[model samples]
Structures are given as C-alpha cells and as structure tokens.
Target: MAKIDKSKELDITIPEEFALRDEVRFLKSEDIKLFRLLRESMNKIEPAYVATYPPSECGIATFTKDVVTSVAKYTPFSKPIVVAVRREHEIEPYERIVRFQIYKEQRESYLEAARFLNNSHADIVSVQHEYGIYGGPDGEYILDFLEALEKPAVATLHTVLQNPSPNQKRIVQEIIRLCDVSIVMVRVGRQILLDVYGADPQKVTVIPHGVPNVHRVPAARVKRALGMADNAIISTFGLINRGKGIEYVIQAMPKIVERHPTAIYLVLGETHPGVRKYEGETYRNMLIELVAQLGMEKHVRFNNRFLSLDELVRYLCATDVYVTPYLNKDQITSGTLAYALGCGKAIVSTPYLYAEEVLADGRGLLVDFASPDSIADAIIRILDDPELKESLEAAAYRYGRRAAWFNVAVDYLGLFHRVLNRRRLAKELAESAQSTGKSASK
Candidate 1:
C-alpha cells in the first residue's frame, strides 16, 4: 500500500491518511462464463462473398473449386458463389452457384461482367488471373473490368512471367494499382512483381497453392488397386501440352527400362483444350511417335482422359516417383506439382521456378530442364534407396502439411477481414471528422 499525498492543495484529493491497496484479482465463476460467451461471439464471422472462376475442365477452375470448398469449412455461416469464365463459342449448363459468365474472347463481355459485379451483393471480386483466360492482347480487357469495378478487388495471379512484354507489365501494374491487394503462390513471384514490374511491395502477398487434405495411402495398396502391384510406377499428371516437355519424360524411359524392366512411366491427362483448339494434337502425336521410336511401348503408357479429383489422387498415391519435366524455366506455378507435393510422393522435376523453390532442401530432387539423363539419374537414385525415398517423402509431407488447403483458406479469410476492417475504419474516421468540422463551424 502507498499513502496518498494530501499535503498539497488540489481540486480533488484523498483523505490525509488514505492509502492505495494493490492486489492480484481473480474473476468470479459467473464472470468467466460471461467471458467465454464473449469470446465465442468475437470468434464467429460472417461468410465471405467471392466472385471468381467456377468448376470447368481448366486447372484454374479446379483450383477455384477447391478454394470454394476448403473455405466453406472454416466459415459455415454462408457459401461462396462463382462467376464462371467460358469460351466465346461455348454454352454449357453451369451450376446454380454460378451467378454470371464471362467469355474469354469478347471485349464487351468484360465491361458487362464488371457492371454485373458492381450491382451484385458480392463483397470482393477475386480475379483468377492467367494470360489466356481473359480477353484482349495480354489480357488487357481485365484492366477495363478492374477500372470500372466499384467493389473491392483481390487478384490471384496464376502466372507472373519473369520477363514480361510491355503490355503484360502494364496490365499487371494496373491490376495491383486497382485491387485492394494481390496474391502470388511463391515468394519469387512477389519479388518479380517488385523488381521487374515495380509493383507496390505492400500490395502483394505470397500464399502457397492449396492441396487437398488427403490421407496417405500405401503405395502397394493403391498400386494393386490400379493393377500395377508388380511394377514400379513413375508418372506425370497434368493437361498435356508442348510446354510440359512430355517428350523428355518419354526419352528417359528407355534408360529407366534398361535397369528395371517392370518400371512403367504413366503419362496421364488429355491434351490441353486450349492447345487442342489452336495447335490440334500435333504435340501428343509427336510424343506417341517418340515413345514408339524408343521401342518402349509396353513400359510407357498414356491415359488420355481428364482425371477427376479422386482419380488424380489415386494415381498420385500409386506413384512411386512422380516426375514434372516442365520445359519453361520462367513458369511460375504448376498445379500438378503442388498436388504431387501434397501427396508427399518422391518428386523428380526439372528445375523450373516453382520446382526449384518447393523441391529445395531435399524435399525432392531437381534435374536439368529437358534432359532425360538428368531425370533418369534422379529417379533411379530414389528407386534404388528405399531410405532415401522415405526421407524425401517425409520432408515433402511435412512441408505440404503447412500448405494444406485448410490453412490457405484461413489465410485468405484473415487477409480479407483485415482489408475490410481497415476500409471500414477509414470511412468511420472520415465521417466523424466531417461531423466534427460541421459542429465547429456552428
């Protein structure tokens, strides 16, 4: 206890002998109950309203679908809806959740989509940005949409080229300038946006690509289920395109087969719809011819179908060593590679931007781009040493757990709430200041 100083004259004073007591306080049981109620109320949140890509054959569509589903688990109050992006000539029955549609090739459609979003009840407009998904040269029409948009926006860039053209650079800069914030899957992407494009450093965030919350199934069990129990499986799964460098994976098969006759390389997924539309199946045929040329027909098989989510997971679980032989060194993101990371398979990949980051620290093995010998040597090392394979898978699985969809979804909600709150605060402050000024003038 400390005695109060009553010696001096004051407007308010304690008694001459008054002393203040200091003691630790404890909450009553009833107060604790009230506190619990208050905490629960604080933790509860309203659902986020997002308008972005819907389910389709595109990998971006699949990613959007996963985002919607995963985000729903954390916020159960309401559901997230979509605004599907379609080809100019396509008309298909979309889900009821799809409130509207935007065509890829029509310039007028972008403005209309913007109008629709501004009038709608959406809280935020999410742009699943890829160069081909939007209209105009280098997707310039998206800039129009963002310009006209009144609602807050968040742009998730699927591709961030290291060396972009003048138009590409301009569009990306405009998007960051217009949107409340922007998201990229890797740190290198954030760095590129800063160093190359001069994007606002504070505007960009790095949230990793999401992967399904999958249970690890034993390779033998899944391999037997797929009728490949006796053979070792090395596989790549993604929409086939010239950029995938499938030919290198094929070329590596002859050498792989020489060491282990039962080793099979499965090339999964159909030709990319965009590639099929523009270039036809020339790339697929070339890969088939190369496989035949090597006399590795039985060892290398192609599953020419679009794999459903379950099917993709099954194939990944069955894979002893997963391969990603992407040729583009500047390629920023790969959904298939993210999935393989999630599945915690022994990954052998060309050192593309994403691979170099995700596969670092022995999480996976990296090889030279378009080099079969490099890929073959990496795969053979994993196959020969069970302990090494286990070590790689263990490390990958640990990392993937940190990047699970659930965590990613929560990160998104956190960012959204922070943004919304800051805006709300600024508006309140401005209104209060205006009211004070009016009162002072009187």
Candidate 2:
C-alpha cells in the first residue's frame, strides 16, 4: 500500500504495467475502462476540512478531528488536511494534520484558506459550521470563504434552530446555497433545514453524530474502580453553563436522594470556555450554593475539569443512569447525550430536539423542560424499575452500534465520493460543450 505523506501532495499514480494494460484494453471497451479509471482517481483524491481543531478546546473541533481520523483509518481516502479556525488571532499549537489556519475576524484569512484548498490536491472541502466559531454577525464571514472556494464544499451544521431570527435564518440559507451538500446529525435538523430555512430537501443528508465505540461493562465494576461502588451514580457531562440547567438538576436531586438515599449526581466537566470568560464560574458557584441550600451536598460531586476520553468513558461506564437537563428546547446536537446513549446507560433528559429524537421509541425517558419535579419523577421511575432500566440501556446500546464513529466515517466518505463524482461530471460536461462549440465554429 502506498502511504500518503502529510507534508506533500497526494500521489495518484497507478502502476505502469496496470496503466499500460488498461490503455491497450481501452480500444475495445473505452466507456467501461474510462468509468473504472475515473472511479479509481476519485478514490485517491484527498479531502480538506475547515474547522476549529484541537488543541482548540471546542466540541466541533474535537468532532472534526475524530471524523477525519476515523475516515482516514477506515476508508481509502488519503490523509485529510485541516484548515484550522483560530479565535481572534490567538494561535494554538496544532498537529501536522492542520495544514493552514484561518483567523476568525480576518477576511483575508478566509480568502487565503479558500485559495489554499483551491490550489492544493484537496478534491473537496468540508466546513464544520457553528455560528460562534466564525466571525461577523451570525458568522456570515464564512460566506467569503465559501464564495472563494472553487471546489465542491459540504457544510456540517452543528446548530439548527427551529425558529431562527432573520439574520440567523439568512446566514444558514446562504451557507446551504454555497455548499454542494448540507449535513445534519439528526432527522429533525434535516426537516428544520428544509421547512424553516427553505433549503432544498435533495441537498440535505442526515448522518447521526458519531459516538466512540464503547464495550459494555458492569456499572458495579467501574464504580468500584472510581470509589463509588456503593452509590447509585447519575451523571451529566459536558462544558457546564447556565444553559445546561444544572440548577434544576440540583433542585431535583433532593427528591432523588430522599428516595434512593445513596444516589449521587456526578456533575462532570469544566465550565464552558465562553461562559467562564464572560461569567467566571458564576453558574457553577450557583449550583454549589443550591446544593448546599437543599442540604444535598453529600449527594452531589463536581469534577471541574475537562476530561480525557478514557476518563469520560470510565465515568460513563460507572454511571447507573445518565441525565441531561438542558434548557434549550431547540438544541440540535449534544455530544454528551450521544456519548451517554452510546455507553448504554439508562438516561433521563428534558425533551430537547436531539434528545427527543434519540431517546424516543423507548430508548430512554424524556421529562419536561426546567421542571425539577418531572426530572425527579423520571429518575425515580428508572431507578425503581430494574426491568425498565435494563430495557432502556439495551435499546440505546443497539442504536449506538449504528452511530459508532467508524460507521459514521463510512457515511461521510460515501457523501464525499458522491460530491466528487458530481463535480467531475459537471466539469467534464462543460469541457465537452466547449470542445464541441470550437469544432463546429472551425
């Protein structure tokens, strides 16, 4: 197998003997041989991604890295090149996979990124779209990058608002217009794109957010390792912010503790970077105060740091039940929720868009938003009913098999091939038209 060097351009050469044989055989079967040659060439083309990549400490950045790595490992695609998005000129160290950087506020950076992809061996560009990651109002600055790109582009939307503000709606619409295809992780997001943004249904694809492949382990064993063997552990993990509605979960905890006296709610993860910069641990402090006020300090624990994937998986495996008490009704994607579902923990969540879609069909229980009593009731129901809890976990795990990172990577590669094939056909048609026009004129 030929290795694709990260520091150099992709090598798309075929073996000389094979090429000679194909050329000789092409006299008899030109169409079949050409199709096979084109297919082989398409398989060799590398894809470039534009996203906030790690060590940037953003979820979308982490996601982009995971998908690119998985695609490279599982598919015939060459090593992916990243055009990393930077925040306000702050340069974070990046791995060699990151070939270029685009500053958020610099218009010229977007143009430079486009030119880099256009001139390089990148056959397609995948833009990981999140409004906050880009500059300008509603992240409209990304439009400049898209406009300058000559190659086929695919936009993977992280947030799909059901009822977007006018500017928000326009930004998304324009993004969809500029890209060859728009990808949403949930079916609801696909519907919202078509109905709310008026995007063409044909252009939208639903690829579920990928979750790490986790082997099912007994909760007792993992909890014992984490020093919580005796407790019925419930957990919520992600960057903590007020929007997480942790206060409601804390409020609900008093009831949970009263019923299951040993029930412990583990609040894992650091405060969201944006939230901490502006609010400075205000929400976390408030949650701590609320825990003390409710006299449930013994039942709540906070691991106030970003966890590595191993640590996160260990915590998830230790959990008896997982909870996501989010306040955002229209929240389109939650990496934490997907992780919990993948781990196959019995889950209780408020009916946010992503949760509603994923936890439906008896995969998990859904409760009302911002209602502590509803949350408590759902938690109590799962804790008390052993049969129900087991059923939920089994259903979630079964679904997780389909949403695993490798499978999702395969879906992405298929989409990229389709986009590339479409671009190739369009270019060939334009060239053929030009050639025919010149011959007729002569």
Candidate 3:
C-alpha cells in the first residue's frame, strides 16, 4: 500500500494504451466481485474541494476551509485536498493541503485545474461557487473547468438570485447541468433554481449553512471579561460594505440608547476588500459621520478587522442582541446570522429571504428594510422583554444545533457518496455495453 501525501499534488497519470488495456481486463474479470469491492471501499477515497481557501480573505474561502476540515474530522476521509482560487494581486502563503492555485483572471488556469482533478485520486470534486470568485463575464470561466473535468462534481451555491439577467440565468443553468448535484443553503434558493433557472428539481439539495459548534455562554461573563460589563451590547459582524445597511443600525442606536442608557452597538469586521478597493472607505466614513451627527459616539464602536472564529464567538456570546440591517432583501444566506443563532443570541434583522425563513416560528424578530424606527423598536422590544429574549435565544439555539458544522458535514458527505455512486453506475453501464458490442462483432 502507498501512503498518500495530501500536501502534494497527486501524480495519477495513465498511459493511453495502459488505460485501454486495463479497461478490457476489468471487463473480463469477475465483474460482480469487483463492483462489490469497489462499493465497499468507496469510503476510503477522499474527495477534493475547489474554492477560495484561507490565505484568501473571502467568506466563501473561510467557509470552504471549515466545511472541508469538519467533514474530514467526522468521516473516513482524512486528508481533504484544496484547489485554491486566487486573485491576480493577492499572493499569500497557503497551507500544504492546498494542492493547486487557480488564478482568477487566467483562462488557462481553469483548464489546468480540470486536468489536475481528472488526474488526481479524488473520488469526486466539490466546488464552492460564487460569481465573483471566478473569471470572465458572469464567472462563465468556471464552465470551462467544469466542462473539462471527467470526475463528478457537487457545487454549493452561495448566492441564488430571485430574478437574474439572461446571462446570469444561463451561467447558473450551465453550472447546474455540469455538476452531479447543486447544493443551496435555503429552500428559497432551491425554488429559484427550479422555477427561474429551470434546473432539474431532483438535482437540487438544500443544506443549511454550517455554523461553529459553540456552546451557549452567559452574556454577562463574556461582556465583563471584554470590559463591556456596564454596557448592553448589540452587535453585527461580517465583511462590511454599503449593502450591510449599518448606517441604519447606527441611526437606530440613538433611540436604543435613550431607552437603555448603557446600550452600545459594536460593529465588528473589516470593510470588504472589493468595496475598499473602489470606494476607499467612502461608505465607512459616511457611517462614522452618521454616528457623530446623531450624537451616538458613546453608543457605537467599530472594530475594523477580520475576526477569527474564536474572537467572533466571544463577541456573539457577549452580545445582548444581534442585528443585521442588510439592504438586500434577496439575500439567501448569511453566515454571521447563522453564527449568532448557533451562539443563541437574540436577533433583530431586516426581512431578507434568509431571515424571514430562519426567524420564522419565533426564532428572532424582523424589521422592515431601511427603516431605522423599525430597527430601534425591535431592539427595544427584545431588551425590554426578558422572557421574549430568552425564548428567542432558546429557539435559535435549538435550530442552530441542527446547522452545526458536524451535522452539515455529514449531509455533504452523504451527497458526495450519492454523486460517486451515480458516476460508478454510469461507468459500469457503459463498460457493459462496450463488452456486449465486442461479443456481437466476434
């Protein structure tokens, strides 16, 4: 037996003649016995993931890392290989697990990636899909890679638009066609795929966004340790941009502080790299101005840096209430909101597609989009009613347990197994047909 070094790229080249001879030999051998052994040993093969991984400061990157690492822990697959997607200017050191890097702007990189996967020992490939991560118009460059790859692929969609342009619709439909299965975080996204994009309903699966398995800790203890003992903390954390609608949250804070004098809003996370690149702190500067103009300087604090999972968990634990005042109503997935729910925090959010579903059945409160008054009222209501806050937190925590990374990883592994089984069945059928034709000719 050979030891597979996951850190290095797999060297699985096959000579054309050797491959043909092996196929003939395989068909002539005891087919049932071979099929049974392959089925039994399927669990031993590890799947590779294609995505933007850590050393790249993208949400999908962090997400791919967590999912792959967690799945490796919970399943028989031990060493998860990563084909990391990289931007042209962003060069950073990657861990040994990253087997290859796909340059975002390089068309040839996609073809190279497809070749790498086809030649690797991966049972299947899991692609973490986000439009902005790939190159070309509407990220159509991913099609080249998906089309070239010979192995099965399972794509996890991060964004599913309700109404997409023709080009956008075509891109998604094509990707769906290429993949063995398409996974979305919410049912709404699945519906959009079926109704809007005309994807095969049977091909889509809903797996909730995975959250860290953090135990519910007392808010007071965490707050006290963080030197926020005297203030009632309200927090929103993620990569910040104009779409976050943080200005509305800041506007809502003055009223919140008036009612509960010690109430403080903690805005955690860095300005989004893309936003910062173009606008250069324009949105953030506007938010700061809004805070000052409203005379809520004492009530608002900004932590302008990307937070580690531990740091994020601590902040969520310390929060009395979590708020997401996103302007985008069609947002289908939010990792920050999912984390807060996992930590069992009372939440207030705009009526986005994700929030409407997750906060249903009394898990959290929803406010009208862009309405500061609604945001303020919701926060005050949660803070004033202790029983309500407790109930919301309990409900969220119960739901969060189901979305914990371990459980989500299991769901992913099951999907991967299905794709692999389907691939094997197709190959077997094709080989059987080939053998039958040869016999007829003889």
lDDT of 3 by residue, 1-442 (tens): 1233344322222112333224434644658676555546546657899999997787999999989877876543246789998987777699998999999999999999999989988888999888899999988899999999998999999988888888888889998999999999988889889999989998999999998887777787777667777888999999999999999989898889889999999999999987898999888889999999999988899999999787888788989999999999889999999999999999999999998889899999999999999999999999999999999999999999999987998899888888888888999999999999999999
What TM-score against the true fold does each predicted structure earn? 0.88, 0.89, 0.89
357-377 per-residue lDDT for model 2 (tens digits): 999999999999999999999
What do the candidate models score in CA lDDT, each in turn? Answer: 0.80, 0.87, 0.87
TM-score of 3: 0.89
- What's the lDDT for residue 434 in model 3? 100
Pairs in steric clash, model 1: none
Model 3 residue 166 CA deviation in Å? 1.0
RMSD of 3: 11.0
